[model samples]
Target: MQAILEEYLPNVMEIPDEFIEATQETIYMTVYTSLIAGVLGLFFGILLVVTRPGGILEQRVFFNILDQIVNIVRSIPFIILLALLVTVTRFIVGTSIGATAALVPLIVGVVPFYARQVEVALLEVDPGVVEAAEAMGTSPIGIIFRVYLLEGLPGIIRVSALSIINVISLTAMAGAVGAGGLGNLAVTRGYNRFQTDVTWVALIIILIVVFISQAISNWLIKKVSH
Candidate 1:
């Protein structure tokens, strides 16, 4: 409501500073984790497709192992995985809690999902193209990178966009542990204090952020397609 905006504006006007800081953390968390996870996922996805059934890189043992790993990670709910990753996160980041520390869990947690997405997209590419590439003496790595990935790029972007949205959602949840962001502001200072106006404002801001991301992704994918 306009009233909510008016009521909370003064309190949160200075919030831009906190929002900026929190936004930086969110950006750091999203960018690094997404990059690491996307690259890892792309490799795993390529191998998954290439090694399965009659894939160019068919290898039963490797395919099964990768499939099981993907299933395992994808099966666990995000919050539960967040909890489980505590120690691994600490070992990786050298601490267990904070936006930066949270990136470890974020990467490990999302990689499999992204890999599966990449697998699906790559699989949609024409098998003939892959076969041609292979016949042309393209290495498995080169074929996977150049043929499958390039061909499926639009789909891959859509997948990445979906992952980015999820990352935003998960990071908001991470604020539960003082990760600090619009989510922390909403949950902590807003809900905990019965500041409904503040809660609404934070929620609106998060929605705006998500929408902005969605718009940018849509444009990028369209450009790639053309």
Candidate 2:
């Protein structure tokens, strides 16, 4: 196995440690960003749904402000966002390079996007169900927990899967800018050095990561739907 892999991916084999480190960094950035962004996105998403007009906790002013913020942040391209957040990332992590520093931009970029996803998921819940819950005198918290979250689980899963895949891509992009990961490996060690085998290996590794994420998400969605 080792001989075959080395023959096909000589560059990667030459720097086994770097390849391993890059892979770890990519996984770290993706998982860390996903978990943190997932919580924040759900909160903002829930707020967006609940504070909008006619919602259980309607507050147009708050909703509009939040909506606009999410939109604005979402509008910024991830690469540009990474550049824009350099100072902020430096402040948070004490250096604007590496996987840790990349977390700031990743979370910032993903939160609003996943929030929108969450908002859409929650919105898809039948209004009649919400009305019935309201008629039953269910508290806002109860309704949010039981009706919005429970009913929107599948949609949320679907969007989350999409978001996780997006995060994987972003991690690679983040690597492009010195956030050491497979992206960094591919760019710095592979593409820049004209090592096509290394580049292909890095790409294949990323694709495997994405495929695993999709598979898990599909399984979860199927189970939830059933």
Candidate 1, residues 1-226, lDDT tens digits: the string is: 7676556575566466776776677777777878888889888887898999899878999899989999999999877887898888888878887888877777777889988988898889998998899889999889877988899999989998898888778777877666666677778877888767667777776778789889999999999999
Q: Global CA lDDT of candidate 1, please?
A: 0.81
Evaluate model 2: give its TM-score: 0.97
lDDT of 2 by residue, 39-137 (tens): 999999999999999999999999999999999999999999998999999998999988999999999999999999999999999999999999999
- Candidate 2, pairs of clashing residues: none
Top candidate by TM-score: 2
Best by lDDT: 2
Count of clashes, each model: 0, 0
Cα distance off (Å), candidate 1, residue 221: 1.6
Location of the lowest summed lDDT over 10 successive residues in candidate 2 = 5-14
RMSD of each: 2.5, 1.1
Model 2 whole-model lDDT (C-alpha atoms): 0.96
Worst 10-residue lDDT window, candidate 1: 5-14
Candidate 2 backbone clash number: 0
